[model samples]
Target: MDFRFQSASPASWADVAADALVVVVTSQTQRKLEGALATLLKEAVAQGDFEFKAGRTLYMHRAAGVKAVRLVWVAAADESPKAARAAFAAAFGALKQGGTRHVAVAAAWEAGWQPAQAEALAAAAAEAAYVYRHTKPSAPKPAAWTKITVLGEKAEAKGVQEGLTRGAAISAGVTFARELANRPGNHCTPTVLAEEARALAEEYGLKVEVLDRKAVEKLGMGAFLAVARGSEEPLRFIVLRYDGAPRSKAPIVLVGKGITFDTGGISIKPAAEMDEMKFDMGGAASVLGTFRAIAELKPKLNLVGLIPACENMPDGKAVKPGDVVTSLSGQTIEILNTDAEGRLILCDALTYAERFKPAAVIDIATLTGACVIALGHHRSGLFSPDDELAAALQASGDKALDPCWRMPLDEEYDEALKSNFADVANVGGRAAGSVTAAMFLRKFTGKYRWAHLDIAGSAWKGGPAKGATGRPVPLLTHYLLDTAAAPSRA
Candidate 1:
């Protein structure tokens, strides 16, 4: 969909010749409404209707003197950023439901809304209108909106326009991430993921390389291979590099744990809800999604994305509990539980990342259920020994509204991974499971400043609204943008 900004007054918005004119209505906006629109809104409110509450919407059809077919009033409980995003989503939803082909949003920027908020609003609207029907029979098409015009003061036009552009790119990235995660494991195996990565690289003119099982073994990725051995699907270590900066620049490396379908191998998971393991690759999806955005935005920074794509199944060839495997970093690991396989694959990937001599490395994974229990579905668990990197990530999360709560990565947690037979143990018992998992990955990332995002919580949802949330893509993208915008390090 196309998005643009126009300079227009709220009273003049009705005459814009659009299918619908959407006006955000807050308690302040209710008193600020003037002329014919005010009278109509006041009358609607007087009739025990259109109370201003966050995300509430009231549609007026063919209102007197309004040229547009409908007027959409989206309520905002307060001027908070979250409320603004919710309001925009509600307004767009109203437009979609009313089958409005082209619409104008007369957003009340007077109510403490910044340009970034405007950008977020537009992005939220795009995201809300997204639907995934990849495998289902095609349904009758709904009336699609061809364009969205954000009506604002002349002074705000440039900022709003820039925001709209950035927001659209971010939203598209998010949607791509969701699509990758939503696919069934059968349809999106390790080989399929490599194909998708190659396609993305080709489309964006980025460098792409896919290392097959033989190449991965040649690199001594025993930890990753152990996890892949159980599955018939060929393992792929996919790398996508984007060098928007000079060759001398040190790149930021993102390592993603892509367990396409985790059946928990030897130490199997319960039968119930095991289907959701298709989403185990959420971290990899987010990385690819971030790549999609940066490719469009073209940030002036070198970036490298690594995805260790494979499956973990309970086949006879699967790695069993107490099995010892060597990692790409030459560290040996005693597998205490086959279910704790995310870190196993991630360890080898993170180890391989050292080849880039990255300034910083961040590995994203749906690694531990303990993270889900600790942070619930709201925030991801962040762990890093580097303070500067953690601070940058936290700030990015705040700006994107995709938050993470930092978890400890002390030597105490490292003690939990002690192994009698190997250099480290894969599972570190039940206590502080999330921290132990981070500690396990931390060992391989010693060559560079690194952080780990345990996204087991925020990757996807369960129940009736079950689907991928497309998280950390926003967080990671924002961080890259900020990094690119900053002055070069000496």
Candidate 2:
């Protein structure tokens, strides 16, 4: 989708045309407004009988307010455009419910609020208005909404506009990741996932490095390689780097579990929707999508993404229960259940990332079904050793509206993975299953401040598949941007 922004004077708003219409107005009751669009709206209200309730959207035969653009109301505050856009979206969403297709917004001018900020609010509202449209074969086409005009003053609002643009672009990237997650195993394989990553790299400015099966073997990624033995297709480890910050900036590292399809190897999964294994690589797609956004935003932060892409098929060569494998970090892992494949691949990748001496490391994965059972679909499970790092991520997620809930990473969870044959066991019984999985990955993180995001429930579309919901891309982007904007240890 393409986005465009235009700047025009208040009088030019009347000529602004669109399919759906939103007329900015003062309060529905008799109240003289004294904010940004005060003069223009005061004059327009006296000239006509237009009714605008706080939460209601009214259609206009002629453009109302100073700009003559479709208008929404901000009660009194001069810097109330953000609130006004919210009102506009509420009314506009209602119009869509009422069968309206397109919407044009006209706003009353504000002296206090920067136009850029107002535009950002407008873009945010529009982006939030997004509804997944991939499912429902008979669903109606979405109505077109193209233009938004703010009335009154025309000061430079470049900063606000840039923010809104960044948010919307990052949202688009998240949706891309979700789409990959929603695909069926038959349609999305490790090979295919690599292709998708390459495409994204080409479109953005990120650098891509892919290590094939032989290369992975040479690197001694035995645990990851063991999991890949089940699939006929060769495996590939994808590494992406985006450095927009000064060369001196410490690079932040992101790792993802790219199990494109998981049939549980020798420990076969239940028959029900095993096909949905296509989404197993949702974590990899997410970080890749995030890199796309970071490339565009050009934040002054050094970053690297590690994705170990493979399929967990149940073939003769597949690693079976009781198998022991060594990781790139020189740690041995006992395979208690072949189904626990995500961590196997991710452990090696995390060990690999330690070479960069990253300022911080974050790994995302659909690692355990137990996570879904624990958090349901409401939130992703966050596990981190560093409190400050966890707090920053949680705060960033909250601001981006992609919330995360912290999961414990006490030594108790680590003990669960204790293995008689190896340093650790891949599966840690049914109790605290998610935490144990996180613990297994922690062994490879070394001294880096690491956080694990188990996106089992958040990675795909649960309710309906109108399109991919793109769960945590925005949250991850928000976190990265925050870190890039301000340096923090751990």
Among the numbered candidates, top lDDT falls to 1
List candidate 2 segments past 4 Å from native. 1-16, 23-103, 106-156
Q: Indicate the worst ten consecutive residues by lDDT in candidate 1.
A: 106-115
Model 2, range 1-490, lDDT digits (tens) per residue? 3333456444454455554434444454223234434454555557663334455443443343333333433332233544555565565554544433334444543343353444444444455455544444575655454444333334444644554567556756775776677666666777877888788788886788889998999999999999999898889899888878777777999998899888888899999877677778888989877887787777788999999998998888889899999899998989999999999999999999988888999999988888899999878999998999999999878766678999998987777888899999998889989999998888988778899999988887543453345667878888988887788643
What would the TM-score be for candidate 1 when compared with the true structure?
0.97
lDDT of 1 by residue, 1-490 (tens): 7888888876686677888888887787566666777888788778977877788888889988788898888887776667788888888777776578788877654553366777777677767677777776593354477688888778788888877877788888898899999999998998889999999999999999999998998999999999999999999999999999998899999998899999899899999999999999999999999999999899899999999999999888989899999998999999999999999999999988988989889999999999998999999999999888899999889888889999998897878899999999998889999999999999888789999999999999988888998888989988999899883420
TM-score of 2: 0.81
lDDT of the candidates, in the order given: 0.87, 0.73
